[model samples]
Target: MTISPDVAAVSTSRSQRARHYVMTRPTFFTVAYAINPWMDTTTPVDVERAVAQWETLRATYSTLGHTVDLVDPVPGLPDMVYAANAGLIINGTAIVARFKHAERDGESVAYATWMDRRGHAPVSTFHVNEGQGDLLVVGSMILAGTGFRTDPRAHAEVAALTGMPVISLELVDPRFYHLDTALAVLDDTTIAYYPPAFTDRARAQLQQLFPDAIEVSSTDAYVLGLNAVSDGKHVVHPAQATGFAEQLYHAGFHPIGVDLSELLKGGGSVKCCTLEVFS
Candidate 1:
């Protein structure tokens, strides 16, 4: 059937207005001075460096117009990133996550409280899986990675919990650990990833998801914190992401690099240390 002029224009506008909604942890929201794994057991210079890094990241994000909400770091949980993992923002409300590590199990309560105070509540929760960090949101499907931090059960758990299809891949390197660690969905049309992080099948699926994804290298990927919030054409990589910075610049992303020297000692990089909630 042919459409009227007004109806056609309205339909096109609605289609173009569609945008991806993401939940990111404001780097400043957490008690990183006491919780970042980089401190290990804690030291003089370590604490000082962590504080500076956190402050700078907080200011950077604030300047970008994102609202930052500070949350009390779950005492004794070193993986505060897990707290951000607790809620998966979909539609609008937060979807609480079932963290694999016991160290972060308490976030369910902490985040639930945070959401409650903000006049939001979690609609559902996973007893066996984490957030979309391991689960990449490409189009309508969720590509989740299994092994290492993410258990095999996490795959079925997340898929069943969220009512979304899950494609799971084995971890290529224990070091890279999380899916976001070695890969990033730069845009619906592009993904920034390194080969070492993907399997043959995973790579193929990624290609199918976004054919225009520009391939980056592990060297730069590691430094840039590949998973540190891609897309939006604005990348917040670590100061060390030299090669990736150039790539981001070429791709039209304003790459803002923050110092992360202390984080390296904890076996985590920029992405691991911080949670980014979208505005």
Candidate 2:
């Protein structure tokens, strides 16, 4: 029995796509050069120092032999969430997000420009919803956090855009600003998150998705800088969370913690410094 040419080609394409794990890594990270986000601390001096960390982080990734792309900025808006805002690498194209926050409204220009200049074609743009803040791209499904930076309508839009079901996680607490802040997908069957941080239902949903989630303490969460890396498996949190560090070790990730007192003062953790561009 001979398979059709289209069937063989499609089978190989599916295999190749599955092997490509979509994760964002920052090469260019700036700490709001246009704003005083340091919160009166002299540690970083200015946003330049924070951006310097990106340079260092890139060098580290280079050692690991992972080729990363650092995206340029959209002019005017200072606190544009490069990691949290726009451009999700779902299937093969970058689906630009419609951010919920007005301050970050114009943030897409820079992303669009980068995609254009680099020949990174975006599949499409959404005028209906917000950006990556609402998304949590796991093994297969896309989990979306509603009532925060992402909208309910946007959730439906992402589902149609990515051709993957977008699961909704309501933002019960404003403090856990993004979906990632409260939870993370460590692997297809494992997770790393604090219990109290997630709602009863959200926690239940996480448990359903990843049953072997490594529960983290509130204190551990703060110290580990759990809010940074988009991919939980490849995390770079603060070194302070000893317990979480051990948990990460068992999970098979080499943790890189930084002196984040300066970065934390402005309410950003490890994930903020890195904005991932998926190919």
- lDDT, candidate 2, at 157: 72
Model 2 superposed RMSD (Cα) = 9.2
Instruction: Write candidate 1's Cα lDDT for 22-133 as tens digits.
Output: 2223232323343222334444235456556666766666666655566676555544533335556544545666666565677667766766776656655434556655
Clashing pairs in 1: 23-277, 24-276, 24-277, 24-278, 25-275, 25-276, 25-277
- Checking candidate 2 for backbone clashes, the offending pairs are 24-276, 25-276, 98-130, 224-238, 227-271, 228-270, 228-271, 229-271
- State the TM-score for model 1: 0.75
Return the TM-score for each candidate structure: 0.75, 0.75
Root-mean-square deviation per candidate: 8.0, 9.2
Cα lDDT, model 1, residue 99:
67
**Global CA lDDT of candidate 2, please?**
0.56
